[model samples]
Target: MPASPSAKIRANVPIPLSEKAIATRFVSFSGLNDDKEHIAIIYGSPEQQEAPLIRIHSECLTGDVFGSQRCDCGEQLHEAQRIMSAEGGVLLYLRQEGRGIGLYNKLDAYALQDTGVDTYTANEMLGFAHDQRDFTPAIDMLKALGLKRIRLLSNNPHKADDLVKAGIEVTERVQTGVYVNQYNAEYLKAKVDQQDHSITLKQN
Candidate 1:
């Protein structure tokens, strides 16, 4: 068996909170070289401490940053923040754009999408994996935060599996569903059919 990661190595710096309304702390690791990759801990109410919740959110610049509705990325991000603020948890915002294929390539993929290619097929055509994101860094971040277990909020079963494989005990799986729009309806279907993401179409 592979040696478990040392706790000391996992414990990095405690970044001071930036936002006043919602207390936030930033954390980083050398293992994740990308400067944009950051883990933000949003403190919950003073009473809820035992079994804090966590959401490993990969960055979606077009969505999270620019409010793009191409997919449900932005909505889910805002929803995660809202829920974490109420219940208390950490949001590990990874900089794995376009499922780890990077930004420029993602735009290329978008172009392919415009030509009738589904999201998965577009990535394949671009010589990329279905989902190139790795959850190891997230594990490291959670460990650094002194978290032994968490109630993970996500729609992807792979996220849960990756966390468990990395030795972070997942106590519960929280569902986060976003409304599907005409722009991303096919894209979302490809995620469900090809990637095994647990997202269903919302009935009107």
Candidate 2:
């Protein structure tokens, strides 16, 4: 008998969180590319009859890892963990860094943004799409976990829209909002004005 979870879940280990005091399970996928070996971390039970709360988080090394305030990635990540713990949810951490343009190029886009250019336009300036991320892998993970429907916790409507088009049902969209700071004021505004993310931040 396998000591760990089945092959689909490469390994299932308990993540003991001191602050929230919740039981967390980190489930690794079976067949993903080396560069995109994403993981699904769960809190509470995702197999409920009601749509489980979920967040499909793309890789944001700067924010998530280093706590960069340029974007709300880090804030959203923490909020997801907290909300999921209470609501019983799943958070899929996809490895599509820099909106699928990889990390180094993302820094180039960042430099362009420094020149007063918008986020999407900066990507176009560097010969990349505005938002090149694909949520299919996230959908694949959800299907593998037997979750056909979910209450998505995100501010990006595009995520929900695309997921529905791809056969997954997005029952409700719970906005993930965070405090705004001077460093990220413009960044947050652009997300609403340009990227169509559902949030209203005071423009400075």
What's the TM-score of each model vs. the native? 0.85, 0.89
* Candidate with the greatest TM-score versus the true structure: 2
lDDT of each: 0.75, 0.82
Candidate 2 residue lDDT tens string, 93-200: 989888889899999989999999877888999999888887777877787788888899999999999789868899899998765886777777878888788887
Quickly count the clashes in candidate 1. 0
TM match of model 2 to true structure = 0.89
Compute the lDDT for candidate 1.
0.75
lDDT of 2: 0.82
Off by over 4 Å in 1: 1-22, 31-36, 45-48, 202-204
Model 2 alpha-carbon drift over 4 Å, by segment: 1-7, 33-35
